[model samples]
Target: MPQHFLLSAEARNLSPIAIARMSEYEAVMTMKKLRWGEGKDVICPRCGKKHEAYYIKSRKQWQCKECNYRFSVTAGTLFAHHKLPLRDILFACSLYVNAAKGISALQIARDLNVQYKTAFVLLHKIKEALKVHKQRETMQLSGVVHMDATYVHSSQKPKNKKSERVDRRLKQHENPLKRAILVIRDSFAKQDDEQNTKQIGARNTIAFIAKSENSKVVNQLANKHITKGSTIHTDESPAYDNLIYFHDLKRVNHQKEYRSDAGVTNNLAESYFSRFKRMYYGQVHKMNNTYLYEYANEIAYREDTRRLSNGVIFNDVVSKCLTSLPSDDWRGYWQGNKKRVETLAA
Candidate 1:
């Protein structure tokens, strides 16, 4: 078949489903390249002058003529100062983007044949970039927003063993697990006037955090992402007792029954946390308290967007990663590889 004729025939025979699938497939193949040729001149890093640069593919380094500045494409990128292969970085990124739950740094290191520390750093950088993008793009949680809390404790011994001894006794007085607040919007709430009972489906979580389940954090998150007058459902936690001050709070006293005054319950959020806890324990095994928020957000983001195409997720992550780069460098790098990256990620 002629090339154009074959292309046209393919398009003609494509169903709506097939076309959508093809678009996703096209996105998954996108790749980003800095410069194409061996002798292409690049601007000097220090002098800001154009100079003939030679790319040594074997060493993956470039030598500039103007200032004798020698650097690799990985220089200044998230992969900079790392000894891992460029291919490994790319593969890890692909794995992170595609994994439904998430792969641990240990698993990544084992797969890539890199040190555990390298994988840890890479994951942190990627998570930071993801968080940056998420904060930049504000998403509103509408309808019934379920609010609840869970606990995650670190096994690391406290610096003060004396205090730890006291804390152990304190734990006997209270919950042993560290507190983690979970707020999820039931995106599947449907009003039924005829039956007078709203049907609630599986929720798509908006935000999940390991912060204190106190009123302050709850109120702050509510004020930030949730719109005013949205129905907020939760258990009879003292923190959420005052939720009515900012939102239409519906309380479900689990002790008596699981239904609130507004006929709502936090079963969805509870289920979400249950699954989240299992995944965290199963995959990550251990997460530092310092980076808990990033880790939680990463899991939540992946879960919420699991149904999305790998290419779409890849582009989303890449855009975020690019934003973390210097403005000039971002523009230059993106201009060169945006189409290619999109093609691969699509």
Candidate 2:
């Protein structure tokens, strides 16, 4: 039998050990190349210009010709004011993208020999960077789109004394921290002309957080992400009933069967939830509601880029981090400057 793609030698291109062995100068040069490209021009973070900057060799910074602002390679980027070595930062990011399910801050701390707080803040900064990068590259999804919502923090454990436990299924007893992650995935079939067969899966994915899978929020997100007139497959959920007004909607009654006689199914979206659930249960044991959207989006990213080699994924993630602006949300996250409220759609 043919071997699975993920287990194949071709998919194992990156090594965290190699990244760890990189010299300080090598890490610095790599970041500079990723941030500014191979050209001589370095954009001034202060003035936002691509003009030439005076490279201060002694200080390892560039002074903007127009603004005279001295900035290091990470200045004004997601790693601004970073305390960790460049090599360690790169190694941490490598480990992050290499994890198929997810990596917790505890795991990062153990791997990098850093404090738990530092690892927590560092991982969150990477998450924030990925979220922004996804937003910056937003495009309308076309073709077969599958959308579904999975609830997090929705279930409560039963009391040891069964008599003392209330009916948790009731709306009044539901966990108030509960939130839904709505994932919209665009799938496509690549025709193998030689074999006259097709390969199918989700090509792109977009995720959002909402209080619940209500019609208003579902319609709003579908309209914003999926292209008009695209064929959307969903399960038998009333929230998706309204999507038919603007696009072609197909439904599979999951309670009765996984697929309909007409081949209607929401397997694409369900596949995303499968990996997300693994991340939730296997890696991140608990997820706070405030930053749940970022976690959801991170899984969406992993699903979309699953076919790429680890090396490619690492470089892509590092590039996005370098291009992302400094994050205020994670700057002083452990301090009193936490996000005041959860980000949710109506």
User: Per-residue alpha-carbon lDDT of model 2 for 150-205, expressed as tens digits?
Assistant: 89889888899978999988999998888889989887667758868565788899
Deviation in angstroms for 246 in model 1? 3.3
Prediction 2 TM-score vs. true: 0.93
Runs of candidate 2 with Cα error greater than 4 angstroms are 51-54, 190-199
Residue lDDT tens for model 1, 1-346: 4353223433232122332233322322222222222345554455656665675655656677766777765454454555554455556777777556777889888877877766876777788776666667778786778777777772335556565444544535454335474656555657668768553554456555543577777777777778888888888888776678878888888998877566778876776676667768788877655566667677667766644566567656754654454323223332352212110000
- TM-scores, in order shown? 0.64, 0.93
True lDDT of residue 237, candidate 2: 88
Clash count, predicted structure 2: 0
lDDT of model 2 at position 25: 76
Could you tell me how far off, in angstroms, the CA of residue 260 lies in candidate 2 after the best superposition?
A: 1.9
RMSD of candidate 1 to the truth, in angstroms, is 11.9
Model 1: lowest-lDDT 10 consecutive positions: 337-346
Write down the worst ten-residue block by lDDT for model 2.
190-199
